[model samples]
Target chain A: MANTEQVKLLGFWASPFARRVEWALKLKGVDYEYIEEDIFNKSSLLMELNPVHKKVPVLVHGRKVIAESFVILEFIDETWKQCPLMPQDPYERAKTRFWAKFAEEKILDGAWIAMCSLGEEKEKAIKLAVEAIEKIEGELKGKHFFGGENIGYLDIAMGWMSYWLPVWEEVGSMKIVNPLQFPATTSWMNKFLDHPVIKENLPPRDKMIIYFQNRSTELASRPHDWFRT
Target chain B: MANTEQVKLLGFWASPFARRVEWALKLKGVDYEYIEEDIFNKSSLLMELNPVHKKVPVLVHGRKVIAESFVILEFIDETWKQCPLMPQDPYERAKTRFWAKFAEEKILDGAWIAMCSLGEEKEKAIKLAVEAIEKIEGELKGKHFFGGENIGYLDIAMGWMSYWLPVWEEVGSMKIVNPLQFPATTSWMNKFLDHPVIKENLPPRDKMIIYFQNRSTELASRPHDWFRT
Candidate 1:
């Protein structure tokens, strides 16, 4: 059986959102042409493809274009039924979706604020980030992964935090996820990053550090643009 | 052929998020016990059910508890396969999810800011709200509903806007979705609200206006509390 659907992805190298889609596609054993976009000077094609957000991690399957990383991940899972990223049972799927949304809203967003902001806001964000991490620690109590024994939907969704959070902490000279405080989350992070599919696909850590260092310096001068990054 | 599983929904009357769940349940012909929660004086059950956010629109099915309207909607659709809220095709489902996310992040959030804020912020939010609505108007160019003919996932997700936006406008004494500017959106709003399930489930208009009026007054007094509501 020869499948001939032209699958393409527009992504930024440092964007966790883009990386999630890339990982999902890779995990499903689906071949895709990846286009790295310059976040500073976004391409016209990127804008045309995702007019609403004009953000990266846009998936184009033949003529159908899908933007937003979560949406794209689900699309990949459904389009290629080989390795299921989502669970089969409805209840399990819902729980997975709930935690994934939490990762984005609480953990990721809080980490961004902690990294990008200054003084009171930074301290507040750090506290919130630690709280979110602790909650996830409880979720990973006995399970090896968020999706028990396998790196399923939630593991992929939250995998970027393992690499990026460390980079963010270094760039900010702050500690949010203390190993002693969040041992379970720390263990899960180690397990998730150790996975071949995830380990191979992540942006280079050294490069990410340099990138964030530059971004942090840039954001310091322009506080208003902290969130845009 | 009977559903014996215990189903319950904890919701708030004025919340668009809660209304979305109610509409979804009615569309699927699912019978469930509805418990209204007081947002001011928090209930123990609401807090226990949704320990993280402690927000309304928590769906308890047997032993499983699901929070967040979008997550609950997906659960409802998957659990009861009768009137399918999501499209059968992967591509179409992806698009619907994208728009539903857009509705929450852009339209709903923008509308909140427009109604809650004062002076410059309100004006800026109003501009953004119009832009989001105009985008949706373009999406509804030739379609009767966001789902086309039938009110599907997106229509249910964004349906609250048809009723609540008008109430916000009346309370604020400002017009965001002018009939002249967004004809297609205006038409779709009418069609959506006219749907029997939607019409029957929505909170009373006059009561909503009074509620928003009081809320706007309170928000005006305490500017910091604007976004939380």
Candidate 2:
């Protein structure tokens, strides 16, 4: 995989978004060179390629730069032709992509809500967190995976919530996903983390806790500041 | 087009999400029977079709139902090959989808920040609004449409922001994309609204002003009670 077809990933190992590409690539068994990026210490390569987002988990297929984790996943799906991320049927594919979006936008961002809220806002955050979980459970009911049996796009898109959110809770000193209240999500998170493909590729829990702890601190310190280089 | 595909759209005229599909349909010249639904008083059919979200801009193509506005746009791109909504290049398509997500999560959500923020949070909302415009302005600098020249996925993704945001501002009596501050975004919004395909598909500005005024009053009056609904 060189010249125009080279598959190289710019990522920080502990990132859930990076983990998303790792799981997909590993599952698909695609050979890609993983370049570790310390996002805080910005690299010229990362800066040039993803000048817009300037975030990691940018997949470079040949010369084409595809930013956005979910977007990269789609490109990977189409390019690799292994471990299909989406269902084959147009309607089913639409359904999977919908939940993929829900996971990214709501469940992941719900962590921000939990972390940011104070007193009364905390209660609202908790309620929204529960709602986010309940929505996922409804989507997951009677299906082994969000894609039903095989782990598909929704599962991969939401894969972070399964593996990383708990680490976020541990580091941020906030407990949003109470197992007692959200047993389905709790169990699913564990089950997903334990799944062999995911387990082998899983970033070390301790490192993630440290990374996300620093991240939460940094974000809270400057809630409005979009990353300054 | 009529008998071949059972294309029916459940939408509220005022909703930007619904408008995404309306514009996509109009751009592709796809004939679809549009059913007007009151968002709060959503019909049983809309609920039955989109049980999970139970939200509008649900596209029913034959018996298959596609929910979420972006998902629907993708579906439309797939179903009707009249005009390709996405890029032919896989990487370009991925980039298009990337900006679309950014538009939904960051750009439009920025508008909501202005809508929802009050007291201390209001300042942060203003910052987010500024960031939103700055980001979009940067994205639109050289490109005629977000997809360049052609109104593609990004244009459809952000279709609502062009008209509805101004309407929302008029209702709330505030300005987010100030002409002097973000001249590029201001001009981009103007160019966007002027596009013939978009111009024809927009909800009547007069009605949208009324709708947004009432909606703004509803939100402003019960600012803290947003979670109750």
Candidate 3:
């Protein structure tokens, strides 16, 4: 079920969420026009396509627009049905989605919170982030990846950890996820980063580090008095 | 594709999340055992099945265990393939999942915060909750349900609003949502509640109200200084 419909992805350069969609497209051999969005000054096209969230990683499939990275990944898989991102079995699919959702709701979210705080709050955030990382590390034990041998939904969902996490650790000067503490996760991360398609698509590492360094400084200046939801 | 595997749902009677799984099962007419859990003191079965969240509702299909209402709903739809909860088209399915996610992350989460707060912060939370409701109301315009004429994935995801929300509103003495502000949502709520499957399976209204009232009071007494995330 190959689609000839023009598929375009609106993305920000340093966004790992956007990378998930890009990797899925490349893996499925789907050709899509990629338009990079200026984060500071978002394009009218991006705003128009995703009015609700107004965030990027929006997939324009023919006349239809789909926002949200996970949603786009699912759409890509369903539309292409080749180099399948999800497992064939229902139980396996559910488990894959569950972990992917955990990646979104916990691991990624916790790291973000940790980045946007200072002092005691930042310490607490880092602690929680480590806990989430440890939980995921346990889940990855003895498996090549979260979904077994090949990179799949859970791997794509947690892809950010492969590249962006080091930047986060360097910028914040905190051990968000150490290879020693999370050996399984470290192995999986290296494996994900080394994948041919993923390796080719990732943005330059130096640029990502600088961007997050600036972001961390900006967040540190803000009043750190809010509780985690 | 029906199997003879024993299906059992571990749920707290007053939980709207649990009700989502129950509704899906009933809608599909898949006979399963219902075990009402004591939420305060969870059962070993519930803990063993869903060690990750340790929350209801957990679906046990023979030896397989699945947790999280939205994830379980997707599983049920896939396994049964009867009374489809999701749309057939991939684009439509993505849209449905998008809104269902919005319902979980915003509407339900926002309302929970509002009910758990007091004074000015509570007022702010209520305002945000209403905004989320209004957004959904806009989405619901001219459709009987979020998925159009049929009750689908988005409807089940947002089903908590139809029943649990009213109790929250009344207990909190807040007009967070009403027909004047959310005419479409109100109508949809009535339609959903009137459906035989939903109506028959819903816990007693008085019981729900009391449970929520107690819950709201308990939450209000707790420290209320959390970020919205």
Candidate 4:
């Protein structure tokens, strides 16, 4: 049933959000046609398919188009029953989702601020980013992964920290996720990235560093309040 | 089994997030203790339970505690296994989740800005809020509710708009979800509020207006960038 339906993913190469969908689909062993979107000049198809946000990582499943990476990840999990990303138990699943939302709402935004801002703003953002990472570190204690030996929904949801955090750190010439501060998260990031599916699918690190370096410069040139939204 | 478990809800009276959990619990016919929190002065228990966000809508089911309104709603639905908030079909469920996320991310923020800001910022926020509401209006076209015939997950997720939007509009002396601009959403709001379960569980309207009025004043007096976070 899963094989018969057409599945297409609109993604940008360097987008951690897009990478999440790709990793989920790959883990599920679901066949999908990946369309690389130029985010700078979004394709008409991408805009048409996801008219609301017009963001990448839009999953076109048959006639239905699902936008938002987390939504897409859940769709992929529910649609393809193999390699379940979410936990089986309701309690565990709730715990997993709590952390996932925390990552999306706090860590992601804090990390973005940490990378993009300069001086005092950067200092405040770095503090926020580190605090968020430390919480994840506490959650990861005595666990191989957020899914406990399996790279499940929460791990995939927080997967960006494994790859992009390092890129952001290097590009900004600053550090957030370090061994002393976040030992468990550091260990979890290593295991998460070292996983076969995740290892092979990541964007080239050097290229990502260059991309973010340019993005930081571009953002810095804008008005002080430009990135407030 | 659900009846056997001790269920307690830690919530604030005026919080739409906390109200969501209450509605879900009542709909499920699950008996639970409701503990009201003074959001102004944080309780040690609330802080202990939801240390990360330190926010409301914390559901303590026996020993297991779940925070985040959306996460708690899903947990309640799964744990009770009756009066299902989510759809049975996967695609429909994905759509429900998508709109829920959309409401939380876009409409909530835009409306908050619209309700709280003044002068140019207020005008810009009104535009953004209206645009977000218009998108929901389009989605609600030809449907009695976002959940189709039943007031389901999306409807509940968006329940705040029915009550709070009006309050915000009256308090701010502005409009966003009017019949002329958002006919479908206006109609859906009527049906949603008319639903017995939702009507019974909502925070009182008069109290909410006063609450937001004071809140808007407090926000107005703060440093211009105070609410930026």
Model 1 chain A lowest lDDT segment of ten = A220-229
Considering TM-score, where higher is better, how would the candidates rank from best to worst? 1, 4, 3, 2
Worst 10 residues of 1 chain B by lDDT: B220-229
RMSD of 1: 1.9
Candidate 3, residue B168: lDDT? 79
Model 1 bad stretches (over 4 Å): A1-3, A221-229, B221-229
lDDT of 2 by residue, A166-219 (tens): 776676567777888767777777777788899888788887677666666667
TM-score of chain B of each: 0.94, 0.90, 0.94, 0.94
> What lDDT would candidate 1 get against the real structure?
0.86
Query: Which clashing pairs does model 4 show?
Result: none
Question: lDDT of model 2 at residue B47?
Answer: 76
Candidate 1 residue-wise lDDT, A29-112, digit = tens: 889999999889989999899889899889998898999888988888888888788999888999999999998878887887
Per-residue lDDT tens digits of candidate 1, residues B1-229?
2245988999989988888999999999999999999989989998888998898889999988999899999999999988899999898899999999988777777777778778898898789888888888888999988787788999999997799999998888779999999999999999999999988998988999999888877777554354331
| Residue-level lDDT tens digits of model 4 in A1-229 | 6446899999889899999999999998888999999888888998799888888889988888898888888888888889899998999999988898888767787777777888888898888878888788778889998887789999999999989988988888899988887888888889998999999999998888888888878886441322211
For DockQ, the strongest prediction is 1
Evaluate every candidate with DockQ and list the scores: 0.91, 0.64, 0.82, 0.86
Show the lowest summed lDDT stretch of 10 residues, model 2 chain B.
Answer: B220-229
Candidate 4, B103-203: lDDT as tens digits: 87677777777777888888887888788887888788899877778778888899989998889899889988878878888888889889899888878
lDDT of 2: 0.75
Interface RMSD of each: 0.6, 1.5, 0.8, 0.7
